[model samples]
Target: MNEKLHCIGCGTEIQTENPQEPGYAPVSSLEKEDIICKRCFRLKNYNELQPVSLTDDDFLRILNGLGTQKGLIVKIVDIFDFNGSWLPGLHRFVGSNPVLLIANKVDLLPKSVNKNKVINWIKQEAKNLGLKPIDVLLVSAHKGSGMTEAMEAIEHYRRGEDVYVVGCTNVGKSTFINRIIKTATGTGDIITTSHFPGTTLDMIEIPLDDKKAIFDTPGIINHHQMAHYLDPSELKFIMPKKEIKPKTFQLNAGQTLFVGALARFDFIQGQRAAFTVHIANDLDIHRTKLEKADELYANHRGELLAPPSEKYIDQLPRLVRHEFSIKEAKTDIVFSGLGWITIQDTNCVIAAYAPEGVEVQVRPSLI
Candidate 1:
């Protein structure tokens, strides 16, 4: 049993013990010519992922190494959770390498949403966050939309140099790389794709025609993600699978809308206006008076409100409120990884809430 041996599926060093950890394989499987760890095995066959995480130190070491290497950085992000999936300060870590931003999961957005507007917004947000990317493109890695364009962009920007694909956990970095493998080598599923964070344990490289390579780096887990605060079973309810149908609620001041038990949006001060919710359609939304919101949530957070489902309710931190005064028209109140609510009317006061560590902020309407 050589501890140095890595899983062919995820590149984590193989170990016989600790099934709960990465690279866990049965001793019986050691004789096989190509052995994937238990995690990848389940993902490949059952399409079910068991959640696992890596230490920040582990990812920091990987990212810091990028600064010393020469390559084009291909940064993937979830369009539905752009801020949550973003690797903050990535520009400083990649040295002078040009970053090509790939915003994945475009298929989950509403059909009415303008693609160019989304691209522009992403570019502005990248600049605001100190990342000046060479280009920004949107694609649905799962559905293959804009993937050809994405591939072309990578080829053009890399310019015979190595390419490094990086992003926070659950942003479809692995899926994006799998698409490349399928196209380049006519082989697929070389890497594991899962809902779990830190699916890729180590850097896996794919050789280009010119002997250059594209490296798939391990996903850095963002603590502020709503995924970290919910049970895996609840993840499906929050992570949208199909195109979203914008649900608009007409409300006056002093009304509250609960997006499952994961987030809350309150119209504190505004004229009667339309509040359009852009979230996973499977997740339930409950509207109530602002005054009764506190009492309702306190009484039925895991039941009537749903999601944490009582069994895992204690795992979530207490909700923390973030207030905003919307001066700009069509402002969106984003609940990090969960989703967002758009306010079309200006001069409105709003308050959003999420689990203590999760982020809630306002931005220009993405649609």
Candidate 2:
């Protein structure tokens, strides 16, 4: 029998079949001195990320081991998808280690958005979620923004101990580590990065000093994210690449807005109000009468209202409604991972709808 080979990059056991699966390398590449899976190859050369599915058992095992390890836990979360990317109850798993929360993708927010306010919002959310980090800082790993401050903060907090970077899949943990590598050794893109989730399969350790190193752990998949239900091609529509240009729609009661057939916002019984949508600028949001919503979705889900685009409409889950009463003057209805709709008017009754498994909730505005 042939001895099993593994990808030098992601550490997945190599296989020649099924390009979609983890650890798939081309048959021709088998004889090469250094072999990497096809997924890592595309990520390195093209800067494209391919999606992979790993069992929950695999991620839980890694997370369960964090408490036993003596290191600083540097947790990264997507600023845009704050709640969706959060690893709930992580404070318990870290034991006595201090956590430094690094919020990635800050560049995606509008320039008008206040940085201090965002940081304060994150700190509050972290406390509410049972994580009391040593510090909360924002960074954009893709744009190389705030990396210097992040590095300084990490070094200061780690105190000669090792660092473990953890976050859910697609939170840019790999890209952030790549930035650290480039800054430290001038190496370019050592870890594979893509827009899709589950890019890293194993814990990759980078030496911080002779005695300590930073470990990039596999991203624990957040099952509640909207990204799981859509096809790879459709991800571009939801994942914002540029600063979000807040889109505000003036609507009266009984109006329905569709966020690419992935989420729905209805002004059920509200006075005239302006709902500012903070989503990927490229995503289409169509407004129609509430009475016509059912007919319109039934007719146009895969077409006019997309991203369960015609290709994957059948696989998409049914929309589940979660209604909220707007008590605060400035409130956000978050459609976890997709984006949010901020309603600045009080005493309004509204309903947010998202795919059955996807999460939708109300919170104070981030901006």
Candidate 3:
């Protein structure tokens, strides 16, 4: 009896069963030859990249296994999406390991933005989440910004100890790891790439020195991130560029601004100083009176005030609002995956709303 086979990449027939042959489908996917496995076609085309996925169970097991090992945690997080970019139970996994937080994507902020303030914000957020990072380093894995500071801090903090890099999915953990790899070994073969979810599952280790090395762990799934709902092109709309241009708007009380459905800020009361927005250049920011915010959101939500496409809105969990009253210098009110609002020195209360599972926070304004 002959069986059928298929490729996972571009569904097609498998002409041969040789282990190394093209169009080779896993035994599990063999039932449907018309549905070619991606691996086969990717190898055949030699143009695309293959992604590795880790199951939730496998992910937990790996984290648990790390307990028996020794290392310092270098938690990498996306600055634009700080709230949604944390490890949920990392403290438990790394117990007293002395973690150092690396806030990636600093290049996405305004050129004049104060980086120290962003670092301070990361510390504050870490404190709020019951995480105690000995230090926080700002970096841009893509543009290599802050890489030196981050590497120096890691070297100092680790102090001959192993380093473990962890973060939620889409926070650029892999790229950050690649940057470290390039600097440490002058190569980029250490990490993998992908567009879908659950890219890294097992812990891939890289030796920093002969005895002391670092570990690169896969990213955990963050369901609430706006990126999950967006297509690749759409996602680019939110991911910041190498350089960011802050958009400043002067407004009085009763004004609202939308930062891609990932965040909505309603300026209710205060002497409005200019609210500068630092977000993905492609992401749109619209302003309106606070009174008409709800109406405007309801009317133009998925469209003008997009991100939560009608499908995303219907499937997405309810949005929860976090109220913050700012009374001070420049402050960054961060909506994970969305963008941040720079509240100038002044007293004002603002309410930000995001999907249920996402995290929203405020940091000392870096600008």
Candidate 4:
């Protein structure tokens, strides 16, 4: 028929070649009764993960167009990886549109953590970035936590206007919207959800009412995310699906901890102190002497350290060091998309190492 077809799951145009790209289906599959791209097909049937390929310019173009459209912006962010999930210059693209910050994956936080404190911290961080959200709500899209509050906030702020949901890739926007759809319509149909970036290539709209609609925008591609570097099987080891049980290590000077061979935390000049790590429970962590850390990593990265899988080892960037000296309050050394370590020690000198371009930030402790 030579007719153009789009995947109903994510709205990406279907093609036969380029399996790495979005909306790719086999020629045989295209001739079938129900046409879905390989990404959607695997996600729906086998529950497999695939990377989404979209350029930074493409995401910026989609976001820039929102400035001219009249709608409420619902910015969904992964609570576990806040910095990695946040789109840079979000305020500039929205052009004064009221933003409702929806922090997804709140269920992943430790049970001992206070929600109010986390919300305040998120607000402060947004304020520092010049993003003044009209409201902030924490929700676990995967578990249906806080979906009602999110809906109420959207309804209240949207005021019968269109609602635009946006965020960086792997932020769980599709899952969040799917929950909203099911909640509002009592339908079991779900939009495709995957750990990979660029899952949504075009906008998918759900009618909220005759006068209003909620739009799910494609996730903005951020090159700085660790997800871009790891294989799909490795993602489960790093991406926390449950509450993170804090792992504390008592370290003396000249010690190092390897976070799955992807990051290193060195106790350069710290006194005998405790460092609390918050990362996926399944990921392996190894401790060794700082002097021999490099030798160990080079010798047995994929075997002992892991997740720079053998296939991706050559493509992984060299570890770049970021040194920090903490003299005051507790601080979190965040490795974007990986997790963070919180340390509270006076006159402590430490250093964090991660693949080049993956952000390693030092921020005031949220706990």
Instruction: Show how many residue pairs clash in every candidate, following the order shown.
Output: 0, 1, 15, 0
TM-score of 4: 0.88
lDDT of each: 0.83, 0.83, 0.68, 0.81
TM-score of each: 0.89, 0.89, 0.75, 0.88
Worst 10 residues of 1 by lDDT: 191-200
Query: What RMSD value applies to candidate 2?
Result: 4.1
Candidate 3 error regions (>4 Å):
1-53, 148-161, 183-201, 208-213, 308-313
Report the C-alpha lDDT of model 1 over 74-193, residue by residue, as the tens digit. 999998888888888788899988999999999988988888888888889899899999999999999999999999999999988988888888898868877787787654344333
Comparison by TM-score, 1 against 3, better one: 1
- What are the per-residue Cα lDDT tens digits for candidate 4 across 52-149? 65677777677777887788999999888788788878899898689999999988888867788889989998998889999889999899889988
What's the TM for model 1?
Answer: 0.89
Which candidate, 1 or 3, would have the higher lDDT against the true structure?
1
Candidate 3 TM-score over all chains jointly:
0.75
lDDT by residue for model 3 (10-115), tens: 3334544543333445566545535555543442344222333345665676567556567677887877777676767777877667888888777777778677
